[model samples]
Target: MKFLDQAKVYIKAGNGGPGCVSFRREKYIEFGGPDGGDGGKGGDVYAEAVEGLNTLIDYRYQQHIKAKAGVHGMGRDRTGAGGADAVIKVPAGTQIIDAETEEELADLTEIGQRVLLARGGNGGFGNTHFKSSTNQAPRHANPGQTGEERTLILRLKLIADAGLVGLPNAGKSTFLSAVSKARPKIGDYPFTTIHPGLGVVHVDGREFILADIPGLIEGAHEGAGLGDTFLGHIERCRVLLHLVDGTSEEPLEAYNTVRGELEAYENGLAEKPEIIALSKCDSLDEELEDLQAEPIERATGKDVARISAISGKGMIPLLRQIADAIEADKAAERGKDARPEPAWQP
Candidate 1:
């Protein structure tokens, strides 16, 4: 299926049923009073996040969504039936926003998360509600209120534990395919991956999702070479795996170019924990590998691993490092959540 991350839709809630205006007419009773029944409520509109879906492509075809109107009231003091509700099923990690006002409505990060988009109008009062001692007989009934309508925007951001980022032809896709079952398109050209792809990596009996987005080049934040549009897919990742091509003429320059784009794109992505690796190490001998990684290691002041996705060199160690980083991030998140809220100051 084609991946679509953003969509705009118009939705309208159901209208309430009109109240009934009727009086009881009995053969035995001489005086008949107003016996009008109240109208039923209208249906509501809700947006729910469900699993097994990762794209908003379905919303592209259907732009308008509306709920059913409530049944009209009868003349024999019978209440109208309520309208059927309208539920919109969206993928997890979809954020709902008001199109006109540019206000955020809901952010569905987990499966089964639901939020009410629009509330149905209230049912009108019946003639019996207006019956009082001052007014012996009521002849009129209120009309049903109108339903609410609004335009909404849905933006999807994929959730992953680790993100793969590098310059084009840096072997990011090769590493993902070697580590996980995801088989993304592979070629010898730049921008081979036009979109983002996801893979589930299992390391040491532990599983975590990994995302591979389109490669970034220098000035990517300024609309150069894929324009850093796919970077949002990895915003939720806890760690980043930066791959520098060992065969490239200047590996450190390539690494610095991608790093510059990440820092320019903002959203704390630049500060995320990163593990640098020299990819396609099998193509180079020990001397070449050391020569290519020496500059990057010295510039970054960190140890860079030598890996070859085709030959499965250094794959296990890389996966273990990613897993450890993921676990550490999870532990930190748990600690933050477990901390008491400032002890409830008086």
Candidate 2:
């Protein structure tokens, strides 16, 4: 299936049914009263997050969604049937925003989560509601109210525990394929992986999701190369695995270029915990690998792991580090959610 992250759609709720005006008529009835029935309620519009879906491509063809209208009221004190509801099922981690104001209406992060996008109109009252001792022969009825309508924007962001970042052909896809079962397109050219891909990495009896997006180049934030459009896919990652090509002429410059784009994009990506690794270490000898990693280590103030995805060198250690970082982040989130007991109050 083709991946689609964003879509625009128009939604409308159902309209309520009108009331009926009638009077009872019999052969020998001396005092006959009004017996009009009330109208039925209209259908509602809802957006739900469901499983087995990862893209919004289905919304591309179907842009306008409308609910069913309620049935009209009947005479002889018989009410009309209510209309059926309309639901829009989307993938998890999808967000609904108002197209006009760009305000985020709802964020669905978990499966089975649902939100009411529009409410149906209320049913009108019948002539029997106006019947009283003074106005026994009421002949008036109210009309149904109109339904609500609006345009919305749907945006999807992939949820992952760790993300991979580097320059093109820096071995990000190779590392993902080696570590997990996800077999993304691998080639020697730039931008081999045009779209974002997810893999499940298992290390030391623990598993976590990993995301690999398209490579970034100089001025990527300014629409250079593939641009930073795919960067939003990794915004929810707890840690980043930054890979620097060991065979590149200037690895430090490549690393700095990607970092510049991340900082320029500025969505807390520059502040995320990162693990730097020199990829394709099998192509270089020990001395050459050390020489290539020295500048990046000095600039980042951290030790850089030498790894080769093809030969499986340093893969376990890298996976373990990513798992540890994910665990630490989860622990920190749990700590924040834990509320301390309050002191005794008067």
The residue ranges of model 2 lying beyond 4 angstroms of the native Cα positions read: 341-346
- Give each model a TM-score: 0.96, 0.96
Model 1 per-residue lDDT tens digits across residues 1-346: 9989899999999898888788888888776888777677778899999989989999999999898777666666777888888988998888899999999999999999999999887777778888899986798787777789999999988999999999999999988899899999999999999889999999889999999999999999999988988898989999999999999998989999999999999999999999999999999999999999999999999899999999998999989999999999999999999998765757
Candidate lDDT values, in order:
0.90, 0.92
Predict model 1's lDDT versus the native.
0.90
Query: Pairs clashing in candidate 1?
Result: none
The digit string of per-residue lDDT tens for model 2 on 1-346 reads 8989999999998888888898888779888798888787788999999999989999999999888877777778877777788999999889899999999999999999999998887677778888999999899877777888999999998989999999999999999999999999999999999999999998899999999999999999999999999999989999999999999999999999999999999999999999999999999999999999999989989999999999998999989998999999999999988968889999
RMSD of 1: 1.6
Clash pairs, model 2 backbone: none
